[model samples]
Each structure stands twice: as C-alpha cells, then as structure tokens.
Target: MSRPNLRVNAPLLGARRSGPARLLAAAGLAAAAGLALPGPVAQADTASVRCSVPDLVEAIGRANGTPGADTIRLAPKCTYTLVTADPGSPANGLPAITGDLTIDGNGATITRPASAPAFRILFVAETGDLTLNRTTVSGGRATDCPLFPGEGVCGGGIYNLGRLTVNRSRVVHNSAVTTVDNLFAEGGGIDSDGTAATVNDSEISHNTAAYSGSTPSSAEGGGLANDGPLTLNRSRLTDNTVSVADNTDSFAFGAGHAAFALTTIEHSTISGNRVRAVGGTALAALATGSPLPGQATSLSMTDSTVSGNTTSAPNGVAVGGGLGTNFPVTLTRTRVVDNTATAPGGTARGGGIHIGRTGDLTLKDSTVRHNTAHAPGGTARGGGMSSATGGTVRTDRSHIRKNTAEAPDGGTAQGGGVFNAVGSTTLTRSSITDNRAVEGGGIFKESGTVTLNDTTVRGNRGNNCAPPGSVPGCTG
Candidate 1:
C-alpha cells in the first residue's frame, strides 16, 4: 500500500498528538530524504523588522509562540492611536508587546484618549527591556476598569509592568479616577509597581487622581507613581495635586510616595504640587492617612529644588503648610522656597515648611526662603519654617531668611526664620536673618532644646506684644 501523506500544524505544538504528530515524523523523514522545509525558519541575531502600529500589535500578540524571533521597529514620526471597543475589558484593548520590540517614535507623539481606562495603550508585561526615547505618552484616563482595577486604571499613558527605560520622554495629563467607593486611586501618569524604571531627563507633570462620591480618598501623583526603587536623574515632578481634608489627615494620603518606595532624586525639581487639607498650604492638614501608623512619609532630596508648592487647609485651623508630618526629610544642597500655608484666626505656623510629631528633618547646605504663614486672630509662627510637637530639625551650613508671618491681633508669633518646638534642634554655620516674628523675632523655641553654633540671627523684628523678657534669642 502507498504511504499516506500527513499534514502538520507547526504552530499547534504541545496541544495534542494526532495526525500532526505523524506529519511531523514524515517531515523529519522528508528532511532526511534531502527535502527542504517549506517555511522560512528564523535564525538568531536577526535584524529588527520595522513595523507599523498594526504589525507591531500583531507581533506582540504572537510573542509568546515566537519567543526571541520577533522584533518590531516603529517608523520615525509615526503616531499610534490605540482604541478599545469594550469599556470593561481593557485586556482586549491593546496588543501586548513582547519579544524584544523597539517601538521608536523618532521624536513623534503617541496620542490616546484621556478618558479611556488604564491598559488601553501599550502593555509591556514581557521580560524584554522596552525603551521609549524622545517620545510623548499623553492624554489617557485611568478610571473605573472592572477587569483589572489595580493594573488597568494605572499608568494611563503606558502601563509598564516590566523594565522600562524612558529617556527624554514626556508623560503628562494622565489621571486615575476611582468609581467604587473606598478604593484608592493612584498613579496619574505612570505607575511602576516594583519594576526597574529609570527616567533620565524626563518630565512627569500635570497628572491627577480624582475619586467619586462623597469626598472620595484619592492620591494623584501628577506624573509617575512608582512602588520600586525610582531614580529620577535630571527629571522634573511638577504641578501634582492631592485633595483631602485639612487637619492631620492629609499628611497620610501618600500621593508623592505612591510613585516610589525608595526615591533618589538628584539634580531634579519637585515643585508646584498642591496638597489640600484643613490648614491652608499645610500638608499636615489633609486627612490622607500616613504611610506609617505614627510616622510621617519619607522624602530625601539631594542637589535638587523643591519650590513653588502650595498646601492649603479649609477656612479655619493651622497646621503644617509645606510638609505634612515631617517624616524624616533630609535636604542637602537643595532649595525650598515660595511656599505658603495660610490659616484663619492667625494661628498658622510653619508657612514654608512644617515639622511635626516626632518627625526628624535635617537641612545641610541648603536654603529655605520666601515662605509665609498668614494668620489674623491668633498666633502665627515660623514665617520661613516651623517645627512643632516632638519634631526635631537640624540645619548645618545653610541659610534661612526672608520669611514673614503676619499676626496682627496681638497673638504671640515667633520664629520669622526658624521655629523649634517640643523637640531637639541644632544649627551650625547657618544664618537666620530678615525673618520677622512677633515674639522671638529670629529664632522661636517652645518646649525644645536648641543648640546654635557659628550661626547668626539678626534683623528680625518683634511685634508690639513681645513676651515680657523675650527678644529674638532670649525669650521669657
């Protein structure tokens, strides 16, 4: 009898053994009989194929089967717009790019809908390193995805669950909104969950997190939210906002902290972000809930700039303006300027920066200036900076000046330059001048131990009702 011909499906490997198995055996016999294979077998080290959006999308979907054989290179000046038909299922939204794909924009922009759910764009879940150079990922909405709440409604621009290297790219105007009550919203622009994300000379700005129904709790990073070791080298985090109640509540919201577990910011700028709480311009006034139960958040800035940020409370009450709960913030070769926390009744303190509640803050080779705490009825202290209630602050080789606190109703105000309260403070080789406090003038100490070495306190004015024997330095 004549041998029967078998047909084999190469792509259907590992499913089941049937006629295809005999076909593979026949193919092996044919190969041994000096017959070449029909399909072109891809070899290793093949050049990346330049592909369009559709081609690239298809390649990503087939990445699992193809493995290391596929590489899609995007065209220069081409823009890819991703659209999904189903609102609930974002998994069916866009193609998953795996297998060493290089989708270069060539200085082009990728535009997506700002109202679409998260993961509607490129999903980099593969192990291959994805690089976006000189590209712009903008205008995506991360909201109300029932399919994948955690991963879907995050990183509206590009959801990177793998290693992402973004160079000179821009991630802007992205937002994550919560539909269900009590669920936290996070990462307006990009959400890196324990991924190795290196952002070099990039800009993450103008992102937000908006929650729904009855003062929903939300944290908008306004840029990038990372739960990993995030390194921002020559980057800018600007104009982020977190809305919550004022009072000690807002400090715990974890807005900026959402972007990183451990953040190392060098030669960068974190400015113009708003934290709405009870006390005006005070992060301590918000009801955001702290990262640690009794401890504040951690922000370490070196050779960077944090300026033009605003923290505001409701109408009444006075709390931390610049920083919320203190939380071990160390600043070296940095600048914190032009920040304000305004409270009614003139009881606001720490207009520029607020150190509170066993929080430890240290400033070395830095400058804090042009911050204000405006109060009318009660006392307003620390025009430039404030420390309160078991908070410790130490400054070395720094300058604190040009801060103002206006308390006109005869309430005692202190520390136009520096305010130390209920904690230990040490200042060395620092100058505190041009600060006006109604009571202590230059340096205000209340229930704390202060040691000043090689420091100058001058040109500060005490108000009319200065405490009996209290000048700028020695108060009674």
Candidate 2:
C-alpha cells in the first residue's frame, strides 16, 4: 500500500530562516516584491493570502516554517492559477506541506493551468496534516515525472502521506497517465497513503486515469485511490474513467472509488463512471481490496446510491458494473441500479453487484434493480447479483428486480436475479421478481445452495428457477 514517489531534494525555507528572524525575512521578501500580504485574521498564527499564486505559495512556505499548526484564509472566489511547481517539491504546484495546516478557501479555487508543466496541486508529507474547506482543485496533470522515472505518476490533484480532510470542496478535471511498462497511473483526483482521509460534502468528477504500457500495468481509481482508511459522507463521485491500453495483463479498476484498506461510504453517490481495459476490468463505480485472501479489505455503505456505471472488457471478462468487491461488504439502505456490464467476446457477470470468491456480502433494506448484463460471444450471468466460489450473499428486506441478462451469440445466460456458483445465497423477507434471462430467470444454482425464507421469486421470464429443483420454495 505504498504511495507514489512525491519526494524531492529541494530545501525548505525554514532551513534558512527560523524563529522571529524567519517571520521578519518573509515580511521583507513580500514587501520587496510589492506583495500585499494581509494581516493576521483572529490569531497571530493565521495568514490571509491574496488571490495571487505567488502569495499562496509564499504563505504555504511560511506556514511550513512555523512550528505548530497554522491557518490560512484565502481570497473569496478568486482562482489562483499556478504555472510552475514549487521549488520545495518538484511534483507539486504548491509547496509540500510539512506540518499541520488548515486552508479556508472562502469559495476560491486553486488550480494549475492546462498549458503548464506536469505537476499536482498539493502534496502532504508523512509528518504533515492538511485540511481544506470550501475549495476547488482542478486541471492538474501528473505525468512523465522526471524526478522518479519508471515509478509512474499518481495523484493528479493531491497526494497525501498523512492525515487529510476535505469539506465543501470539489476535485475535478485531473488526470494521471503513465507510459512505462509494469507501472501505474493511479488516483486521477486524489491519492492517500496515510493514516486516514475523509471527504464530506464534496464532489469529485471528470477525472481520468490511463495506462499505456505493453507489459503488465494498471490504471486504478480515476477519482481516488486510498491505501489507508477512507470515509466519505454526503459526497458525490461521478463521471470518472480508468482506461488501459495494454492487451497483455494490464488492469483498469475502480473508475469512481478504489481503496486497499478499510472504506466506509455513507449518504454518498457513485455514478456515471466507466472502466475500459483489454486485459481486465473490475468495479466501474466502486471497488475494494486485492485478490489475495490475506490482504482482503472491507467496505461498508449506508444510505448510498450506485447507478449508471458501466464496464466493458472486450478481450476479457467484465465483472461488477456497479459494485465489484473482493472482500467483506455490507450495504444498508443502499440502491444499486441502472448499471450495464458488457463483454462482447468474453464473459459478463454482475451487472449490478459482483461478489468475488473471497467476498461475503450482507444486504439489508437495499435494492438492486434495472441492471443489464450482455455478452454476445460469451457467457452472461447475474443481471442483478452474482457470487463466485466460496462466497456467500445474504439479503434481508431487500428487492432484486427488473434486471436482464442476455447472451445471443450461442452463449449461456443464467440467473437474471441471483446467480450462485459453488457459493451460498440466502434470502430473508426479500423479493426477486421481474427479471429476464434465457434460463433461470429468478434464481440460478450452479452447484451451490440457494435458500429462500419468506422470500418471493415470481414474475420472471424464461423460468423461475433453473433445473426445476435447485432452489427450493422458488417455482415458475
């Protein structure tokens, strides 16, 4: 769970100026440069920065020079466009945060010009803690990093190695692209390898992560990639993309949200995201964990919505159009709908949700509906929900309906509602209806156990249950 290399050998301003002399020297530099530095707001530790990019950079450098935590108030509604990286960090537009700092944007913006050099907007070191409020960070490109060759670029908008919290903010129009083999282009919007990162009342959209390598590479988390604990509340992550142009063994994963550690999402929305990879694709909207059982993570969602997500893997299997999980998951009062998964020449599974072989899911008071899974030249299964071997899915007071699975090119289509392959599926007080498939319109049992308790499986097309006696209490 290591983050991208954001380190540089540039010296800090505090190295030359410390204590009262540093403050005096900073004020002298500002005065000599004809800079209008605002007086302290409420406290001596607070510095009100003007709307200029140079002012912002100098303020950050001053804050880094201070010993304790500092507060920086920015100009209202002004967009500070940076055209060069800070001398302290070669990969960041602003100086690297070396200590605790809070920036009150006051509805302003911090961005890098599209024609500027390749660098991210912000970088927080391991000992730094950053908090942003009412800010907008956009138009950052982390690509072709000469500082760290072969490591690939990451965190186009912001990179964090300590505690980071963002509130009432937006991160958009950022990109992370890599040109090396066996490298990664990760976190188009934000990347965190810290103790924790939280986002509340914010939006992350229009970000892209693309990997173009002939060897085994990966493009992950078009919106965010967190290697530590992550929590999202009342936020939206939409219209992000992860694309891989390698037919070898490359992967494109988590177009909206990707995390390798504990992830919790509440009252949030993840929609309109896409993933396209020739080697493989997973979790077009939300995904977590790795393939290894020892490193499996956990995800919990409450009162959230995952919709209008898509996945396309023409050369390989497409799994989990809306939610692709490889660890433990629990969804309460969540809705996963209107997702599409298509693999024209390969297998397609889990239009709404896919539970991997090592994943066990619990759904309570949730709905998985109006999803489609299509594979014209391969197999299609689980238009609503699917589970692999050794996985278990339990639903209580939930609804799975209006889902379709289609395989029209002499391929198999099974489980329009729920598919259990060598796994266990148990439904309690749930309904699986209005689903369509060539076979097993309600429930498909492929060498697994399907138990229905106080659940209704009706109004399905083709058939209610495959093999007639596979799922007890469910009949056409």
Candidate 3:
C-alpha cells in the first residue's frame, strides 16, 4: 500500500539566500579561516530506495541533512538486513535521525542479522521527529553506551529522545542486555525518555531485557520503557520477558510495559509477560504511575485486558503480577485475571494488582479474578489486589472472585480477595466471593479501615474477614 507524502516547509535559517551566493560566502569564510566547511544543505525529497542496506543508509543520511521533513519509501516486501553498526555516533544500524523524518515502509522489514554486533536498530536524537508506518523491526541488540555511560544501553529496536509515532508496525525479537554490574539495560523493544511517543495499531512481543552481570544489576521493560508522555491505541504487548541476576540487590520491573510518566492506554492488551528476580521486587506486566525523580505520574486505562502475566522471585518479594502502580490510576471496563506472583522464600503480594504507598486506584466496572499468589516460606497477601501504606482503593460495580493466596510452609496467607495494609478501602456495589486464603479469605484490614456500601462479601474459604468482626457486614 502506498502512503501519502506529507510536505513540510523548510525553516528559515537566519535569512534565505541564493545557492550560489551562499556557496560563495561559505567558500570565502573557509579560505579566510583555512577550515573545511560542511556540505550544502539538501532539499526535501520523497525518494524510493531499493532493497539494499547501503541504499537505506544513504537515504537516511540525505533525509537527515535535508531542511524539511523528508519521506523515504522502502522497497515493498524486502528485508534490509544490517550486519554492522553505523560508523557514526550512537552506533546504530542506520544514522541517528536528527531532523524531521518519516519512513514509509511498504510492508518491508529493516532488521539486524543475528550474528551482528550489539547495536540498536535506530536512534532518534532530541531534535528529531520520526514516524514509522507499516514496518517491522526485529533482531536488534543493545549492550552498552560508550558515549553516554550514565544512560546505559537501552531500546534494542528503536530509541527515541524527541517525538515518535509508530503505526501498523511490529517490534519483536529484540534484546537489551547489561554485561556489567550496576549498569542497566532497559526497553527491549523501544525506549522513549522524556519525550512524547504514540503507538497506534501496533504489536510489541517476544522481546527480552536481561542483566548478565555476575553480581547484582537491573533490567526493566522487556517490551517498552517510557519515562515520558506515552499513548497506546489498539495495540498489544505480549510474551515479553525481563530477567535480572538472582543475587542480592538485583531488580526486574515491568516485563511487558513500564511508564514513569503520564500514560494512556485504549483498547490495548498486556498479556503473557513474565519477570524473574531473586533479591528485588519483580513486577510482571505493567508498571505505571510510578514517580520519576521529582515528578509524579498517572495512568488512565480503558477497555484494556491485563492477563496471563507471571512473576517469580525465589528469595525476594514479588509484587503485582499483572499491574503495579504508585501514584494515581483510573480503570474503566478493564480486566485483570489469570496472573500469578510467587516468592518461595520471601513475601508475595498482589497477584492481580498492587498499589504502592502513594497510589490511589479508582476502579469502575472492572473485574479482578483468577489470580494466585504463593509464598511457601514467607507471607502471601492479596491474591487479587493489595495496597500499601497511605494508599486508597475505591471500587465501584467491580467483581473480585476466584483468587487464591497460599502459604503452606508455616507461612501466613491473608486476603485472598483484597489486602489493605494501613490503607483505606471502599467498595460500592462490588462483590467479593469464592476467594481462598488461610486468613481473611475475603478482605484483610491490617490496621486500616474498610467501608462497604451495598457490597457483598461471602462464599470465601478459611474466613470471610480477619478478626471475626473487623469488616462490617462480613461474617467469619
């Protein structure tokens, strides 16, 4: 399919001049200073490139040098395999996009060969504006950043620092690994840091972010990591995995998606994502609403499904197998189900959703069910939903059922349906039933208040509520 070209006007650089006059001025200045001057600026052009890596590289270079936004059309149904990194800065397969550029991929693929050295596929600088349409990015690996060591190596497929839009694209089979200790590897598929990115009708799946250090290290966002304003519409992030060393101080977060800024998700699915950690908390699928530095974040999700996600921390804590948040969140018509959180020698909390100390969750018309949390040698709490200190959870017309919290090896299990630890919980027109736990099978209030208005809590195993009369209108 052909995409229409978008024409952009060139910016006026100080003052417009004729080509010959500008060349003469540049030559006279170079002669006076005895310094080599840059080449002439190229005009914007819509070019079609053949199925060659060199042609693609040259086309991107020309587009980057153009004054206005240039559109490069890739050869249809062709695979442009990159075997080596660009000999320029950032060490990407193609030149780093520095200006407004768009690549109209007519069902074409641009990927790195499996035997290629560790390098990202694309990088968009802070002054760039990149748009990708109908493209596939795969088989990219990012190891480290020599130029910017503090930033570490991130975004195996595409790294965006300015503005980015991806439509009808697939980002899969990419990896970002950290070989050294304390250094990090983030965003196996894409990373947009302190920028704006929108993904429409796209799929990001089968990506990995791992830390291979002998000691402790961190790995985050197997599919995507964004510390900026991000929007996802009609998209899916599935089957992504994040792994960290099974040592102390190691951490892995958000195997499917992680956002530390304001984010919006509409008609999206985050499913089948996994996380493995040993000494730090592992959040499996979605980790949004977490504050970044001094800025607080929030998430607004509608018509979304977060299911079939799993997290395991052998000697550490596992929190939120499906969704985890720390600021504020609003969910409408969403479902969190079939997620598992396991911590064999540690604590396991929130098999479905975990709200941190500063989090406030407003769930409307949503469902949390079929989730499990197991801690064989430690405490297991909240098979469905758990909130930390100073958190507030409000549910309206929601259903929480069929969840399990088990600690069979002399450990304690509490709140198979909902766990509130020094937090406030209000349920209006909601039903909590068929949950299994050793104590507080329906709802657990650990020094917190529980308010129920027209809510039903019954059919739970072990006990309906802890302390016999802790929760009003709930039977033990």
Candidate 4:
C-alpha cells in the first residue's frame, strides 16, 4: 500500500540580522581581534538538519550502510505515518544507526498504522548508541501480518534491542498484540529486551497489550514491558488494561499483567492501570526455574503513589489489583489506595494487593486504604492486603485502614485489615483501623505467627451476630 507523500519541512535558522549598521559593528569587532571576519561569530559546529518523518527514516536507512558516524535531525511540527506492512525484506522500513546517532525529533510526531502490527513503530535493532530526544511516538500496535506473521514481534512504539536513551519524549496510545509461542507480550508503548534503556522526564500512558485471542493465553503489558535494564526517572505510567476471561476452563494463566516490567518500578507513578486477570497489575518472578523467578523486578519507590486502579472478572478469582509480587516488595514514602478488584465468586479474592508464596513484602511510611473486594455470597478475605503460603510481610510506620470485604453470611471472611495465611507477619508502629468483615475484622492470622508492636487496631467492626474478636493491645 502506498502512503501519502510526506512534506519535508525545512530547518528553521535563527533570526537574521535586522539592521546593516549592527552587522557592520559585529564585523569591525572581528577585525580588531584577529584578521578579517564576516558577521557575528558563527555558532560552533552546532549545525542542525531538518527533515520530515519519511526523510528522517530514509536518512537513517542510508546511514545504516555507511561506515562512519551519522546523525539525522527531524524538523519540528513534522509528522510521519507508517501505513504499509512489512515489505518482506531486510533493511526494508528498517532504519539503521550504526554509530552514535541522534534522531532529534525537534518536537515532531511519528505515528503508526492504526489497524495491526502494533508491535513496533521504529524497530532499532543492531544499532549502536541511539538517542531519541523530544519526539512523540503514538498509535502503534502489535500484530502478526498474514504475509509476515512471526517477523513483526516486539515493541509497539519503538523496539530498542541496543543501548537507548529517550529524553523529553512521549510514547502513548500504543499496544503489543499477541504472537505465536510468546505468551507474555509487554510494553504497549515501548519494549526493550536485553537492552539498556533510560527514559527521563517522559510520559508513557494510555497504551495497552491485547492478548485476548492467543493460544495458551498470555499477559499483556498496558504501558511497557522490559526484559532488560530499564531506568525510568521522573516518568508516569497510567490507564492500561489486559482483558482475559475469568473461568477455570477458559482462564488460561495469562492476561492483565504488569505493563511495565516483570522486574522493578522505581521512583514512578504506576497508577490507574486495569488488568482483567485475578492479579491484574505487576507480576514478578519468585525463584529461578520455579515459575517466574527473578530479582530484577525489585521496585524501590520514594515519593510515589499507586492508586485508583480497577480489576474485574466474572467468577471469584483472587485478583491482585495493584501489583503481583513474588519477591521482596518494598515501599517507602509511598501510598497505595483507592484500587478496586471485583470478582463474582470464583474470580478473585484479594482486591488491592496480592503477594505470592515465598515472597517478602515490606512497607514503611506508606498507607493502604479504601480498597474493596466483592465476593457476593462467597468467601472473600483481605480487602487491603493478602499474602499466600510461605510469604513474609512486614509493615512499619504505616497505616492499613478502611478496607471492606462483602462476603456473604456463613462465609469465611477473615482479615479485613490484614490477612496472613501460612506466612509470617510483623506490624510495628502502624495503624490498622476501621476495616469491616465477617470475622477477624482487624487482623486475621491463619497458621502464621504474627507479631504486633506499638500498633493500634481500632474501630474495626465484624458481623454484629458474630462475637467480637481481640483488638490491638486489648487481649481478651
């Protein structure tokens, strides 16, 4: 398919000399300093070339074969659209940057085909030190074209399999669709596998990973998926989704997973993303060779907020709405609140947060509140926090309050504030208050040793007919 002809805008030079007398004064100063000189001191080798989207891509493709260094500059207000499918040839639509190349967008907009092949807009594989500055990549999605089904697999916005640095750029409204055996398709905006990428002062939002029709099911990353060393400084990830059916026969172990990383989220806002599985948000590995095991997903946050996310399914399957961690999940100076998980009865159990077995969770100077779990005449426990077998959770100088569990009568509703099953828990200098459930309104402990020190568990009410349980510091 032929794309519309793109108009390449010319580079805008700085303002020219207005008055002739001023230009003469600048020339006289040069004569006094050295030999003859022309106008104002010509700015040092800061020459900038301007090109539209197609011209920029063409220049990069030409430089890919050259043996020297090349840098392509994009003009401001310029837009490039990807309309054709993969031409079934190497170096076809594949722009290359061999040396240190800087594709300065100059505030340009690069768009992709809206229909399919949402995987990548600019595939930068085998590039050496690529830098994208002040550019915007949008409307890209991952898809397997009938002509080249398995070829276009990876990154929806920009696939960087090399050292990449993106500064002051925006990657939004992209998606990563499903492929063949790859059950985990991530990075709705950008996907980097085994690459070193740093995104600074950027926004990656409103992207999605559509894996609803994949065999064996899969997890979709609404914002980003990184299987490499990725550092996001001063960035925001919000409003993404992964849709999957919530049934034993149809619920094939994939959907609504972390759009960012199976590793870590540091100093960023991972809020307002929706995942359709039991635990919709982030899922980290537990131990190597076990199921999903890796220490790379260790999210260290300071002054960040993870709130206002929602997860929904038909049957009651326990969905960890915010994050699903299989390792030591730690939060410092963070706030996790106002997230919801809705499951009928066999869909979900934990509403806000779900910790897996053999994982350690630590929260300091944080708050987890106002989360809800709707069971509808079934057993649902741990509205705010839920831990599984062999899990260790510790919270210090924090608050866990105002969470609700609407489990029906004669149902097992335990731990409205905190729920621990087959795991060790420690609460110190914290507040667990105003949570409601059928039993263990404040705290629920099942086959796990819980140690509480200098904490207050107050105003939490259980079913009126059920007998009151022990409050913090008030042992019956």
lDDT, candidate 1, equals 0.57
In model 1, the Cα lDDT at residue 339 comes to 72
Q: 1-476 in candidate 2: lDDT tens per residue?
A: 22222112101000000112222343465467586555454333889998888889889999988767899999999999999888867788899887889999999999988789989998887568899999999998885332234466778998876679999999999989877776778789987766678999999999988888777556778999876678999999999998887475556778998766678999999999998876465445687654333443578999999999998888577788898776689999999999988888787888998887667799999999999888887888999998855588999999999998888979889999888898889999999999999999988888789999999999998998897888988777
Backbone clash pairs for candidate 2 read none
Error of 3 at 223 (Å): 0.3
| Candidate 3 local lDDT, residue 158 | 87
lDDT by residue for model 4 (1-476), tens: 11111111100000011112222343465467586454453221122545454555557656565544556677776877766544532222335344456777789877875654333566655345677899888887655321123432346676665567888898888777664442434556776653467888888878776554433334445676554556767777777655443232212111222322334445667677776544222221111001223233454556666777775654535445555555456778877787765665543445566666645678999988887666665566677777745577888999989987666644566677776678787889998888877776667666666677898877886731123332324332
Misplaced by over 4 Å in model 3 are: 1-44, 145-148, 292-296
lDDT of 3 at 336: 97
Per-prediction TM-score, please? 0.74, 0.88, 0.88, 0.77
lDDT of 3 by residue, 305-328 (tens): 999999888878888889887768
After superposition on all CA atoms, how large is the RMSD of candidate 2? 9.7
| Candidate 2: regions farther than 4 A off | 1-44, 143-150, 291-296
The C-alpha local distance difference test score for the whole of candidate 4 amounts to: 0.57
Q: Tell how far residue 283 is off in model 3, in angstroms.
A: 1.5
